[model samples]
Target: MNTRFKQLLQLSAAALLVTSSSQALAWGQIGHRVTGEIAELYLDADTREKIAALFPNQSLAELSTQADSELSNPSEFWQQTWTWHFVTVPEGNEYSLDKHAPKEGDAYTALTSSTETLKDPKATVEEKRIALLFIVHLIGDLHQPLHSGNGTDRGGNDVKVEFFWQPSNLHRVWDSGIIDNQNLSYTELTKWLSQKITPQMASEWRTTDPKTWIKESIIIRDGIYPEEPKLTYDYQYQHIATIKQRLQQAGVRMAAYLNEVL
Candidate 1:
C-alpha cells in the first residue's frame, strides 16, 4: 500500500483502539488527531523539519493525544497534570488570568510554560519533546469549549444526560459522543475538514495567543449547555459546526504557535 493509505489505516486503528479502550477525554483521540492533521497542513517547511528532527518516528497527530492518555499514569506528575487539560472561567465572565489562575495550574498556564520550554536553548530534547506534546494537546483542549469550563459543573462532567439514549454527560457529548455517533474515522473526518478549510478561514483562525483561544472557547462554552436531559440530532446539529471550527482553529493556531516558537 502507498504511504498515505497506510497512514490512514493506522489512524483508523488507533482511533478505534483509543475509543474502545479508554473513557473519552478532551476531544478524545479522533478530535486530537484531526487538529494535528490540520496543523500539519499549515506548518512551514522549517517548522516541519525541526519537529521531524525532534520526533523522527511519531507524527504530530500521535503526539497530540499523548497528554490525555498519560492521565492513566499513577505518578504524582500525572496527578498534577489533571488540571492542565482544562481551565474554568465562570459562566458569565471572560477569562481573566488573575482570577482564573489555579494554584495547581490550568491549561492556560501549562500552554505558556510548554511554549517557553520548547523555545529554551538550554532545554533538553526530552524536555522539548514533552513540551511539544503538551503544546499540541493543550491547543486541542483549549479549543474544546467544555475544557474552557465554567467554575461550576466540572466542565459539564456533572451534567448527566442521555445521548442517543445512552447514559452520557454533556462533556463526553462534546468530546466524542457527537463525533463518534457519526461513525467516521479520524482520517476521514480530517480529510473532509481539510478540504473545507479555506485559506481565509485558516488565516482568520491563526491567532497565536492561547489566551485568545481560551476566551473563544469560553464564549462557546457559555452558549452550549442544554436545559433538556435528552440530547440527539438537534444538539449535534447545533454544535457540530462549532466543534469543526474549533478543531480547525486549534490546528491553525497550533501551526502558528509552533512555527513561532520552534
Candidate 2:
C-alpha cells in the first residue's frame, strides 16, 4: 500500500474509534438536542433573551452537542473533563454528592459548578457561554440512567450485548439504541414529548433537585439490566416509557435551572 493511502486508512480508523467510544458517555446527539429543544420551550422570556444575548449566533439546541464535539479535540482541558460526562454509583448504594464524588469530578460537580458560573455576575461572557453549553449538555447526560453508572462495568459499557442483532453494549444501547431505532429526528421527538407533558407533570418535574435526578436514574438503571445480554423487541417495549420520562424530566429540569440562573 502507498504511504498516503496507509495514512488515510489510519486516520479513518482513528475517527471511527473516537466516535464509538464517545457514544457511551451520554445520550446521543438526537437525545441531547431533543432535551435542549424542550428546555427552550419552557424558558421564560427574560431567560430566553439573556441566552440569546450570550449565544448570539446559536440556540441552546445547537449548542447542546458542543461538549461532546470537544471530545475529538486534543487538549488538557478536554482531557481533564473526561470524567464529567458521567457519575459512578455502585448498585445497592445511593448517589450522594458529598460521598460519591469522583476524584476527577463527575456530572454532578460539573453541573453544580457550571450553574454557579452562569449565576455569577463577575463571570465573563466567555465563561458564561461555555458554562451554559456545558450545563445544557450535562443535564441531558445526567438524565441518561447509564450516565449515573453502577460502580462496576464502566457504566455498562463493558456489558457486551447485541442490539437488534448488531454488536453493541448495554451503555450504547441505552445511550442511543432505543431512541435511534425509532428514527425520529430531534425536533420530531421534542414535539412528541412536548405534547405529552401535563401541567402537573411539568410543575412536579421542574422542582426536582439534582440529587433526585441521580437517584431516580439509579433506580431506573437497576431495573433496566436484562438477565441476558441479548436485547431485542421485549427490552425496548419495557423500557421505552422510562426513556421518555427521563428525557422529559431532563428538559423540564434544565429549563428550571436556567430560569433560576439566567
Candidate maximizing TM-score: 1
TM-score of each predicted structure versus truth: 0.90, 0.89
TM-score of 1: 0.90
lDDT of 1 at 111: 82
Candidate 2 C-alpha lDDT tens digits along 19-60: 222333577888888889899889999999999898886777
lDDT of 2 at 149: 90
**RMSD each, Å:** 8.3, 8.6
The per-residue C-alpha lDDT of model 2 at residue 245 equals 89
Model 2 is weakest, by summed lDDT over 10 consecutive residues, at 1-10
What's model 2's lDDT at 186? 91
Q: List runs of model 1 lying over 4 Å from the truth.
A: 1-23
